[model samples]
Target: MKNNLKKNKEISKEQIKNYFTKSVSNFRNNFIIISLSILKNFRTYVYVILIPIAFLMIYSWYTNAYKGDFKPPELFKYMVIPSFAIIFLVNTTVSEWKNSVFLKRIHSAGISRINFFVSLYIFNFLLGIASFLISVTVMSIISLIYFKPSNGTFFSLLGLLEFNDWVGMLYSLFLCISISVSIGVIISGLINSIALSQSITLIFVLFSIVFSDCFLPIDLLSLSKPLTYMSYFVPHKHSVWVGLISASSQEVSWAFENPERPGRIISFGFNLWIPCVTAFLYSTLLLVSGYFSFGWNTKK
Candidate 1:
């Protein structure tokens, strides 16, 4: 711990002050230490990083065993997307307050907390996007080894939307993750324990899993329609839906609906657009609430 503390020191004030006066976006002004600090803390733990990685590998197996090409997207829509997104993105905000020395010093550093927080958010956003792409790439690569993707096939799921098309989805997921992590950070920040951060994280996972439609088919649960519709507003569910593509999670729709091996197809109109809109809205609502929560309770 002593060595860790000694390693985290920034350069002298003279350099920072001089660099600040010279330019806002200079390399010195935009220090890499912050980024290094984040990586050092978040990636140092083997378990934290590997859990998501193992989950992705499991997802690949599930996708590979799927009979239809589109089923890969279905698995992602229902399971992999939400699970992986939550694991990585939530790490940024949720586990922020484990260290007494760093947290206290940074909070009292006389710098703008909002700016500090925003820089952290930007890193999480960029990391989430990169991780998302990497997971999809890994899935695609694994799918190629065991599953064949033909014309308009499973791999084409990547091309289902342009980068802009996914902007809302990514933003929505980011906000959901941010809100969750922020709440955890506030608790951890106040309590100053790593265990508390994880405890809160478990509760959140329970909440998100319960509310998320990924647990069981939200439509097929045989619950009352009104109740089902009511549950759709939950933030994590909104995140899962936000990042969903146009894929159905059914084996053979006609086999169940028609009892014959009838061709099944997914409709793009409501299936795609609805999630895109709702996720953005839900994320916005959660983020707005989180912003207030962070201000009111996170600082101690």
Candidate 2:
């Protein structure tokens, strides 16, 4: 009897190990397949790399000519990074929703929902990173040649501590991108009509651009107490703050007031932890909702 019990335990252990191994393998295969499929789209690379670079160049020129500063402008980061992340990712995810053939293949192959969602997220994240590198390189070259920056170092425009600051900035950018990606996935899962998807995407874009406090300060917009507190719900608000904190390489102080815009209270400090925790929670919640809600309900 003891021998039989030991044998049963060993079999259970083996079965659990095999189950995990198969799951890992399946996930890896899904990732590789998704990566290869996305890589085949040359236009994706061009659009992702060029559009932002073009915008950056034009904005850099304006800043250099008018502002007389070649340093990376705050407005550019605020406008571009969030815009790129949302537009690119939302469209990508929506396209997947539109692809009936792909959906059928995934279902027939028995691909798990987690694997599908994660594969999409990771691919988009890596693509965002690629776009970032290309944009930075192009901007760096332009600054080196045309801008004649006063700092004498292109990296300085990104903020202090050179390498460390860049990492922080990238982390903040990735956090923003991650949140955007989650939003995209959730939108794709929930919406079935392409027209509706486009409409919603437009609304998201408009909000991120205008109301995200990108053009005007949130302080100016928030007249009521509820409106003031509600600004925290905007993802872009936190994204911008985190990027600014990372770039400044200075500790955030809530008491510090902007000299240019007086009467407005500062909303700095806890920059790192605030965005990190917020991103994690936002992504987790959205991804969970997306997974449960995903379906082949798109209009043909």
Extract clashing residue pairs from model 1.
Answer: none
Candidate 2: clashing residue pairs, number: 0
**lDDT, model 1, position 283:** 55
User: Could you tell me how far off, in angstroms, the CA of residue 138 lies in candidate 2 after the best superposition?
Assistant: 2.0
Cα-based lDDT at residue 251, candidate 2: 46
Residue 148, model 1: lDDT of: 51
For candidate 1, the 10 contiguous residues with the lowest summed lDDT are 261-270
Backbone clashes, candidate 1: 0
lDDT of 2 at 188: 70
Task: List the candidates' TM-scores in order.
Answer: 0.63, 0.80
RMSD of 2: 3.9
User: Tens digit of lDDT per residue, candidate 1, span 1-300?
Assistant: 877665555445667777677544433332454567656764533323455456656655654445554433354543334333444334444345434355456556544545555555555555555555555666665556555545343456545555654564455456555545444434444444456656666676656655565544433422445544555655566556544442332233411233232332222223556665666676566544544434312344
Q: List where candidate 1 sits over 4 angstroms from the true fold.
A: 1-31, 42-49, 60-64, 68-98, 146-153, 157-192, 215-227, 245-278, 295-299
TM-score, predicted candidate 1 vs. hidden true structure: 0.63
RMSD of candidates 1 onward, in order: 10.7, 3.9
